[model samples]
Target: MSSIAFMTQAQEYMFTYSKLFSHLKQNVKQGHEDVKVGLFFLNADTKKNCVIQKAWMEKEQHYEELKTTRYNELLLPLDDNLKSANPLVFVRTPQDQRCDFSMVVMTKQPLKGTVSYTEVEMLLPQMQVMLEDLGGMFASWFTPDVEGVTLEFQGLVDGQVEFSNGKTKPIVNGKAQVALSDIGQGGSMILPQETSRVLPYLPRAD
Candidate 1:
């Protein structure tokens, strides 16, 4: 369906593409659309809908070029608060259906702070609640047409959440660790390394 169709069919029509792209990376053509493109989907450490891809293309639009435009259609902005709280929303599409759109609470800067293991443990409660709330909200929006989810960031990233066929596995180490002081000093906001758990799981819009 088109973007407008998504809005009319689902309540969480507008969402971020980051997690949607991240979780849907494998299904997202994995690498750049063009071999010469410099941009690729972001390798985020969080599970928000990290969709969309970064392409260092020539910025030339061509009918046959097929460079970054392949992924550009999916970009959309979302609300803030996702980053401030670093909350992640996880959704399992309707039984055998594909998710048409994803809605993530965007973050301004992907969390790069150092907190003791105690802090992560403390943050778990709030994160869990947000995840549950988001899931419940989007459950009714899933359709069997495709196989995937849409993720939009509010505080950090936001934009169009369109329908596409892609997939990405959540980045999970399983062995959780608490951050030490200055642990995240070397990493940039976009390049998140010392994240608590990069557990994002998305398949494709089918």
Candidate 2:
């Protein structure tokens, strides 16, 4: 349901997309019996702030002021795996404030078998686009510390779905992996120092 990623000087606490999607689906189903929500992709950025106030004495009067200008917020997505209809939620920096993708089945009873085939076909290509954008945008985040680190996700189905944008390979075995650093370096990305700890980092999505 939740996990924590401890960095050299940072701490990231967030939720897993799969679990969140399951929860959402359950809620949606309960809210509307027989209604199934197919979630293809989800990216979101949210900012939250905590204010600290202090009192100071000036001359004979007391004054109160907010102490800091920086704000604190949590960034997370509905899914992390780029699988068929599976939620792929992750966190990223606040610099890019955008919600990349999200899809929901508005009707009662979830789409099944051939009913979902067409939609999946349309969704994979678009997801690949997001993948390329994400890889290039956060290329700098990859360090030797993250060398060989990869992400894989797929949908549970009776058959298979393969997708590629020419630059990347097809999704095989119902799974796909995108090397975060490989995008920027043309297969020449430098590696970070290998260490005991695996730095957990994800670009914030909206």
Candidate 3:
């Protein structure tokens, strides 16, 4: 089985567990007929309403609810494993996003029922890198043009920052570009007309 992680626009992580049922079937074919699989969501805080919102299998034409434990952990039944290759289980959670939450795949023996913090300590380094990469990808989804306007501010050489439309930009070498925009009105800038610089009079042509 393999896990794929996705980041939603609301900053939530969705995990899709795939090839699990099929893998269990392979184990059955290898003469180990009683192969059992358990999917555990480790490090979830039940007190803070951190629970899985939904779990479903992605089929050809529709979705089927994957049976999970009361706490949303999945314990695959031997009957289901022998029947078909239902290879996908999608799980969505609305809790605060953190990579510390890991989905563990346990097989053969009955699950330990509890995961100690020390057991997952080695996973932090890899999870942290994944988190950082996901964050960068999330940020790259919105560019300056879509989110706001980049306004270039000149004449400030004192290393000051200019603020507009709730955004700020630090002035560097008398120039700074600020991303400014209003939620509904977009963005606008007003420039004073130089009325004192009058144009020279011209004679009418025949």
Candidate 4:
């Protein structure tokens, strides 16, 4: 095959691989959230699980007490009694799907404060209930056709959610949008050059 033909074939294979893995990651994160809430309702140690997850995500100084403290302050209680509370939404772009991305917006009021372990422990049930209710209610809105990128806007206003597909005008839904540059800013993941590792999962045409 000509060099151009080879390059095109390799690029196609990589796209396929990216789609496959992206879908897998989305499924896993969504499924895991469901399982965590279910377990929490069943009196499982869901808070500890959250801590462990935070540690993994940070992947640096997992033993740092300050990080743990902040994590707890930012997420706990799950009630409206918080002094200062804000929406904590998690959005992730899928590998291969019709929709641009998937997101989980936790309860309208996510707890925020420094509390004793026992206090947080006492509030676990409320937190779990809120999470379950919020997740179940918003499940439909996050399905595969919601194409657009969400961004967080904290300007003169309290906070704003900016939505855009990078073509038409941005849509403001009065909520903070999750800015996923890799998806919203298209062509962010393009490979600079062809390589032998492009078709690892399939037979090579070359």
Q: Tens digit of lDDT per residue, candidate 1, span 31-50?
A: 21211111222223343332
Residue-level lDDT tens digits of model 3 in 1-206: 25556665543444433345444334344322222233545433432123566666655776677676554455554555434654455666655643234433222322122222232232233323322332355633432111222122223343533222443345444333322222123333231211111111112212
User: Candidate 2, TM-score vs. the true structure?
Assistant: 0.20
lDDT against the true structure, per candidate, is 0.27, 0.28, 0.36, 0.23
Ranking of all candidate structures by their lDDT, best first: 3, 2, 1, 4
Worst 10 residues of 2 by lDDT: 190-199
Model number with the top TM-score: 3
lDDT of 4 by residue, 1-206 (tens): 00111122212111122222222233234333321221110003211212212311112232211122322212222223221222222211122211211123222223222212232233333333433444456643442322222222212123322223332223232222222332243222111121101100111112
Q: What's every prediction's RMSD, in angstroms? A: 17.9, 19.5, 24.0, 24.4
| Global Cα lDDT for candidate 1 | 0.27
Highest lDDT, which number?
3
